[model samples]
Target: MAELANCPKCNALFMRGPATVCKDCVKREEEEFQTVYAFVRQRQNRTATVEDIVRGTGVEEHKIREFVRSKRLHPAQFPSLSYGCEKCGADIREGRLCSNCTEEIQNGIQQQDQLNDIQERNKKKDLGNATYYSMKRDKR
Candidate 1:
C-alpha cells in the first residue's frame, strides 16, 4: 500500500493521489463556502467577475473561478466580473500592471536606447578623428 501524505489545506494525513486536499479540509472548505459567498454578495462587490474576486478577495483566480462555476459563488452576484488583462504575465485585476514592474521595464529599455545612441555617436566621432589624422598624414 502507498503511504499517506499531508493535506495542503490542513496538513492532515491522507492517502496520497492526484489530490493534495484531504476529506476534512474538504468539509472545512464546504463550511467556509458561505463566507466566500457572502463577501461576493455585497452591493459594491457584487457584479465582480472571477478575476475581480481574485483581486478583491486575494483568492487564487483558478480556485475562485472553479467556485463560481460550481455555484459556490453566485454568478448573479457578479455580473460585471471579467478576466484581467495579461500584462507581461501578471494578473492585472484592476489596472494594466499588477505592480509598477512594467514601468521599470520601459525605463530599462529607454536607458538601453540612450546608451546605444551614445555608443554610436562615440564610434562616429572616433571615425571622424581617424579620418582627420589620415588626411593630415597624407598631406605631409
Candidate 2:
C-alpha cells in the first residue's frame, strides 16, 4: 500500500516520500528549488556562505542544510560549496580554517607562549642575581 500524507502547503493527499508536498505543491516547490539551485550552482555563487543562500533565495539556512544532508544538494558536485565552522562559526569550506583567521589565531597563541617563557626566564634570573648579591654582602 502506498503511504499517504497531506501536503503541508495545500492539504492534498499524496504518496509519502522525501517532500511533504502534493503534486501541485511539488511542482511549485520544484520551480522554487530550481531557482535556488541555479543561483547556488553558479561558479561565483558556488562557495556562497549561508548568508548568501538565504539572501539569494529567501530560503532558511536549516532548509539548505537539510537539502545537503539528504543529498538533495551535493557539496562535492559544487567545488565552491562550503559551510560555517563548528567551533568558531566562521565561513569555511574545507578543514576548519577560514584560513586568514585561523592563522591569525595560531600566531597569537604562539606569541603569547613565547612572551610567557621570557617572563619566566627573567624571574629565575632575578632570583639568582638577588641570591648572589646577598652572599657577597654577607662576606663583606
Candidate 3:
C-alpha cells in the first residue's frame, strides 16, 4: 500500500511503497550506484573498500554502506567492501557486529546469568537457614 511520505534524502512529499525513498531520490541513488559500481569493477579497483568507493565515486559513505547491506553491491564479489559494525565500528561484511564484539557481548551475558544464578542460590540458602519462632506471652 502506498502512503504519502516525506523523502528522507530530499525531504520531498512522495508516495511510500516498496521504496522508502521517493522516485527522484531512487533514480539519483541508482545513478550513484552505477558510478560506484563502474569504479569498483575496474581490475585495480576490484578490491576497493567502502571508503575507497566513497572517495573514488564521490558517493556518500552511508549510501554505499546501504548498498552493501542491501546486497545491491555484493560483498562476495567485492572482497574489500565492508561496513562498520554497529557495536564497535569495526569493519564487518555481514552482520551488525564484528566477531570480537559479538563474542564479548555474549560472554558478558553468560557471566551475568551465572552471577544471577549464584545470587538466587544464595537467597534460597539464606531463607532456609533463617529462624522464625513464635513467642509465648502470659495473659496479664
* Each model's lDDT: 0.66, 0.73, 0.91
Worst 10 residues of 1 by lDDT: 131-140
Among these predicted structures, which one has the highest lDDT?
3
| Cα shift from native, residue 119, model 3 (Å) | 1.0
Model 3, 1-140: lDDT tens digits are: 89999998899999999999999988998999999999999999999888888888899999898888888888999999888899888888998899999999999999999999999999999999999999999999
Descending-lDDT candidate ranking: 3, 2, 1
Tens-digit per-residue lDDT, 27-83, candidate 1: 766655655576687887776666666666665776665565455554455665433
For 1-140, candidate 2 gives per-residue lDDT tens digits of: 55888878798889977766788976876676677799888888987765788898887776665465455777787554456665676655565557777888899999999999999999999988884334445554
Per-residue lDDT of 94 in model 3: 96
Candidate 1: which stretches are off by over 4 Å?
A: 1-11, 15-20, 81-140
Candidate 3 runs further than 4 Å off:
137-140
lDDT, residue 131, model 3: 100
What's model 2's TM-score? 0.46
TM-scores for all predictions: 0.40, 0.46, 0.85
